[model samples]
Target: MEIEVRDLAGLGEWSAASALYRSVFGYVEPEFGVSPRLLAALHENSGSVIGAFDRGELVGFCYGFTAVEDGVIYHYSQAAAVAARAQGAGVGRRLKFAQAEAARRTGARTMRWTFDPYALRNAHFNFAVLGATAIRFLPDYYDDGSSDRVLVSWDLSGHVPAPSRSDEVVAPSDGRWSAPDPPDRVTLRAALIERFRAGGRLVEVTRRGEQAVYKFREADR
Candidate 1:
């Protein structure tokens, strides 16, 4: 399926995007739907939103914005949706890759986003396949009372100076990730959680061939 992707406002595909979200998310009343005006505001800001079309049909989309933090500017993805039919064809993955590219073009050092925790599929995509990490787990962060999703922030611009996990897991680990044993010498998950609450944490999961990796450093207790 030939697809075209570009930065566009919510206006151009407002109707179709909404419909796609409703379809994929399976909402009877279309709750938490995005409006064209809201998307336009996001578009006018530092971040550029994108849409994907296949055969002249709106199949997927995403939207978010950039912010200044610790003297560095980065984009944070808010929401992304794809039609059910297009799920297996790599449309969502492509859209995410495109979003990361857009962030790099803007000179941002990172791109962050939140994902539902209970979504097993998302775990494979965000954590394993895409190599994202979870520095913190915010319990009921959304407080929406109806969803079990957690916030998963990612870094798009690997251009930033940071530690490298060059030899932990040996490649081809596409979503076939395994959670390593908790740190043997420490209980630092709380501190990590705190860092996330303060927005000072950005988790990076590296894949080495078929093996996935999660690496971190805490005060050696």
Candidate 2:
């Protein structure tokens, strides 16, 4: 399928993107939904609202805004979602690269986002596919203890090296994609927290035999 990645324009496109976002994430609560008005405002205010279209249909989308911390300017990608049918077809990656290009045009050199630590697919995508590095482990990112996130930073202009084998590995005993059991979840969470606390940065997720393992290396000082 021919996929086109570009900036979304007009109310029609914005509304469609909003609907797809809610649908992909199954957001039932009003508070969890993204309004078209918010997206329009973000588009007007130097934020990117990019979409991947397949034959004029919105297949995937990503949105982010310019941010600054400690005098360093960067782009903060808040959310990205691909339609269920369009997943595994490189649409999400296309949306991200398009978003990064937009950010680069605004003079930003870094892009940051967060993902669930337990989602091994997301971890692999962020570290292995997109060359992002996990810099922080947020215990309760939403303030309601509903989610535990790993904050990742992606260099917009640099070519990051592929991850190498590391001595530190976090592997689940059960070989599950996620830690569903409370005990397993707690153990994995604590291990990741300790690694991040000691200046470790997650660089890769690899498979050793039948189990997936996360690899970390010391962050550059």
**Candidate number with greatest TM-score:** 2
lDDT by residue (1-221, candidate 2, tens digit) is: 78999999899999999999999999998899888998999999989999999999998989999999999989999999999999999998999999999899888999999998777778778888999989999999999876899999999988665555354655553444655678877887888899999888888776676556778887775
The number of clashing residue pairs in model 2 is 0
Tens digits of per-residue lDDT for model 1, 1-221: 88887777546576666667667777786456766777777777767578788998888888778876778887888788888777788888888888888888778856777665333466668866776665456655668753333455566644333554322212223344232233410233344345445544334444555444434433112
How far out, in Å, is residue 207 in model 2?
Answer: 2.4
Report clashes for each candidate as comma-separated counts.
Answer: 13, 0
lDDT of each: 0.62, 0.87
Error of 2 at 194 (Å): 0.9
